[model samples]
Target: MPVPRPFPPRPFHGWRVVQAAFVLAIFAWGIGFYGVGLYIQTLSASRAWPVAWLSAAVTFHFLVSAGLVALLPDWHRRFGIAAVTRAGALASALGLLGWGWAPHPWLLAPAAALTGVGWALCSGAAINAMLMPWFDRRRPAALAMAYNGASIGGIAMTPFWAWLIAGWGFGAATAVVAALLLAVVWPLAGLVLGRSPAEFGQHADGEAAARPPPAVAPAAARDRAALLRDARFIGLSAAFAIGLFAQMGLVTHLVSLLAPVLGVQGAGFAVSLVTVFALLGRTVTGWLLPQGEKRRLAAAATFVTQVAGSLALLLGGDQAWLLLLGCALFGIGVGNLLSLPPLIVQAEFPPAEVGRVVALMQAINQALYALAPLGFGLMRDVGSTAAAIGLALALQVLAGILVLRRPAP
Candidate 1:
């Protein structure tokens, strides 16, 4: 009663890392991912280049990023996170400048490739790796929170790029954003990414002492070669690849599909709605996700929900409400699709192997989904929006089944 209250515990430094990672996701997806669309449109109009050629360059960009993403763990281990992140920031800045300044059509190739290298280092796998050493039991929530930056990136960057390009022209706008990226990322790398839990003399999730690692499958593989042979790894990779392929395809085509029903502005709003729900979905899942195991089940359930959304869109036809409803349902699972994989890896694989496993899976997933726009476009041209959406639904269903499957003990 009369005694003085004890001091409150110190704030977790890992939360600062989470904040840094969040900012990294914003820039990573904002420029590296969503910025591709801006490059495609601006370059095509300004250079009078063929849309197909520019699109091919974008595809190449993603492919290069996918290839390099597989090597990120090795790079991180060799170079350290701060060094690698700062290097990526420099590369990305230069690449953006290249995107705006490159005069000839063929010049886009090298520019795209350079951007891809930067993208791989800053992308989801890197985000997962950054957080892994600092978080354990609470990682689901941590990842969910961190990955929300991606959705935010899409929401913020699209309009920002458009406005800047309109006023300053593409080259000037690109230069300004690139400089901004460097200013923000350099300090972040030094301040947050460079350090670790042990360095801070703290435990993950702010525990007083370090906890024992969770139980992993006896069949879990320790090395990349062994992981390639593991059934669990295969299943996880396949599930995510299939789901993402469908998702990217649908999202790429969504605006055109809805334009007739909702007009361009309305369709844009729908896409923004999807991003909002994606952020909301991930936040809820992070809070509710069980401590260990069941992550696969949660992932499967996400795909199933997406499958329903696909069905609703397939049937929505001229009904705007129904289409909007489909978008909300589909969007609810979008963030989970990206955030759950690393969590699943953490649950099923050894801690030491988490970075490698996540990297490889991300690479595979990115490589496959890079084709979604073209694949879904072909489906739309060959048939109709319904046809494309139907294919997405089928893929989501397959993903659900695959995620639920486990290899024999």
Candidate 2:
């Protein structure tokens, strides 16, 4: 009796759901998001299409996804997450094929639209919705863990796509990757996403029994319409949108900016380093995030770090070590920007309204980020690299200010 040891607790099924969401994010971000630049380059080279025309298609792809993502909550409510996810996989597969097969410039419109539809259903909002039913208290950590897949997707897929295109040509590469996406995501959607916490005789966070949902303040909004009008909602959405606008613009131009200083191979490595730092940053923030107002402050601080990084890059100029340092600083905030918004929504809104709020926020961010590349590129063309970086840095500063302006009770 004196030497007795306690039994180990069983693994929580919610963690398994996290794992599934993680895998889903990998493909969603890989093919739909990170692969866009490669698509532009390949289509440009092989089809002899104008880069400007292809870039517009890329912009349209993001805009379409933005519109569709706003409706994601409603779609999931009506059709169910698993079914919607399966449809997304199918759409994504077809879209990838369409990218390679489209013979005319105008054809890219339908191809971009198809990929946009797929991306809307498979990306951030979808991942958040997938995990919402399973974890309440642990939501931050779960999302942080799952969102890392996006970074992993970028790190793994960019080079992989380039290699595939190099070896097999665009058509064969697209077919193979599309096939792999369908094979993995279709079964995954059915297997893991089909079940809920209740199905496994569990409550959120794998609790022993049911507990009351988190308390909402008397002034808290209850429905999507009310949430849309809420000051907090507006503030949160604006801050994230502005921050992401900067992040997306900077990232889209980062390789080109660094190439002048670090050379081609070094520039590519820097971008990969940014993804690595993003993974590390998001993981740390998610695990250590405090509740309530402090969370907003933490989010604001991330923007501040990015601002400093941008400034460093601008001032660092042709100095490789200083430029690399700036990249590290900027990279630290990249994943946090994506992961923190949902956490903010969770903290400010009631459990019932979380899905819609998150969806709307993501929609807003995407709409702005859709324009980021063009906006930044224009700045570079009209002025200089410093001007583009300056524009991003200014927006990030504004984002930090906006986020800290929590609505008064």
- Model 2's alpha-carbon lDDT is 0.91
Q: In model 2, which regions exceed 4 Å deviation?
A: 1-10, 213-224
Writing each residue's lDDT as its tens digit, candidate 2 over 240-336 gives 9999999999999999999988999999999998999999999999899998778999999999999989999999978998898889989999999
- Model 1 whole-model lDDT (C-alpha atoms): 0.89
State each model's CA lDDT, in order.
Answer: 0.89, 0.91
Task: Report the Cα RMSD per candidate.
Answer: 2.8, 2.9
TM-score of each: 0.95, 0.95
Return the lDDT, model 2, position 42: 91
